[model samples]
Target: MNTKAFLEPMGSWAWWRSWFLIFFGCAVMGTGFVLFINPYNFVPGGVYGLGIVFHNIFPSVQVGTFGYMFDVPLMIIAMLIFGGQFGTRTVLAALFTPGYMNILTRLVYPDAAAVESLDPALLLGGRLDLSNDLLLTCVIGAVVIGVGQGIVVRQQATTGGTDIVAMLLQKFAGIKFSTGILLADGSVVLSGLVVIGFGIGTAEAEPAGWMLTLYSLITIYITSRVIAYMLDGASYDKLLFIITDKHQELRQFILEDLERSATYLKGKGMYTEAMKDVIFLVVSRREVRLVEQKIRSIDPRAFVVVTDAYDTYGEGFKPLPDADTIQAE
Candidate 1:
């Protein structure tokens, strides 16, 4: 068989993996909404919270139903503008999530009045009955909900609804993604102020819904920042360079004492007729500190430069150097 010929193209496996990832990501996000926050009467940031607002304002409306209905027109617009991949993923998230949500909402809330929280911690720590306060609900709700969204993003998938729309708005309308999401989610949060014949606008009405909304925003912000920090860079390694006349002494000392590697560069001094050696080494951040200490000790006049490098792939940086050379150093 022509193995090389077959290997010439990247094939079906990539597409299958992408689909699996999309399904898994959506399931995790849907689970977060259904299991943790929905029955809790708290909305997390983004479209999920908007669904909460929708259900609250119109008690006859189901959040899952709202998600399903709201996503269709957006998906259609996205499909027409972006093409099949974007539209397909949007469709999958919108269709699958509403059923999960509707099922969960029924199981948790069907005529089940918000019973007094029997948990001692809730009774003691939360002064009022747990059923009524939006603050507590939002605080706890955002954590579960935000984590769900993070999992989908980490896997490079969408939770199906407004996430896709946010992305489209960012791409076509030149709005920032974060800004677009804030607008979409903020509108949902604002509607929460007027749910179920209660209006927070009055001096007497507690702004419980808005409290939860703010908490969700804070939680979502913190969660996304954490995710970005984790993915942005690996901070373990650094690069160093020394330009000096005592290159041989420094090179031998570094190579022998620290058991590290260095590259010597050939250079001509600007005025004097003298050759100089520029030594370069890649090592851990700790080693960079040590190297600086040693160079200053050996010759205070030696010029040095250091930089942060993401990773080193060969020799001492990543894969271990030959054991013999290491021991010899």
Candidate 2:
């Protein structure tokens, strides 16, 4: 296994950046849980989702404390099973996130009585109380949580809840990672349906049993999509396939005018039986017009195909993950 990612020189910019992302990401995730997810008892998955389910039964114990109860043991088991591949950053993120959640809960609900009682009405003076608009709340909460988790993942670390469980399932039970995650989170969501939705652990039964389940599914879907968007970036990059005769001129225009690069491929027209140069270029969405105009000016009959470049990585684009980072991941 490549160790360079985890063994980055201490005090380097990469090291500092990784640390910052971990802390900031964990804080944002905790904030999303404390303010949006936990108050509404939305079990969106992971240890926190289970914590929310259990919180209904034991309101006195904060969700973050439950996170610790679940994560610490999982971390130890993961280390034993996977060995050093776990990485220090992941362990730190897992440990720090729960504390952040617990602290944020305390800060958000200053009144001890309100906190212990798990009073949703007392949260943030009801500023975030969108109990009336559950859908909107779920979307916003999912986005916040997804962005935070995305940042942590980008730094080659994880918040380490159900992720470890998924890994374990994959290793031992021959379950696919994604499938394992779905099963784990799905169970947690189901638990919410039973515990909170059915009023099994509450003073009264919630009327929104199936509705809560649906909303939780929506939350999970949106959160996953947002996290994917965060990691892969916006699909606003345009890839151009230009079939033109003026290769030199177009190449000059791309290099000097556009400050971009392109690859040249030799091709032949099936009908014409003539050799040609295919210019493969990738540019931002805004640059497509300029490129098209330049191609037209150079070769009016240029056959240009433009498509979306969802994610690009290289010297000019996003930097590729280093070996150490990749291995750590």
- The alpha-carbon RMSD values of the candidates against the true structure, listed in the order shown, are 10.0, 3.7
Off by over 4 Å in 2: 1-11, 80-86, 166-183, 201-203, 319-329
Clashing pairs in 2: 5-324, 5-325
For residues 26-140, could you state the per-residue lDDT of candidate 2 as single tens digits? 8998888888888877899999999988888888898988998988877777666665645566678899999988887888785988787666688877666688888888888
Q: Relative to the unseen true structure, what is the C-alpha lDDT of residue 283 in candidate 1, on a scale of 0 to 100? A: 80
Candidate 1 lDDT over 196-231, as tens digits, reads 125543333334555655665664554344333332
- Top candidate on lDDT is 2
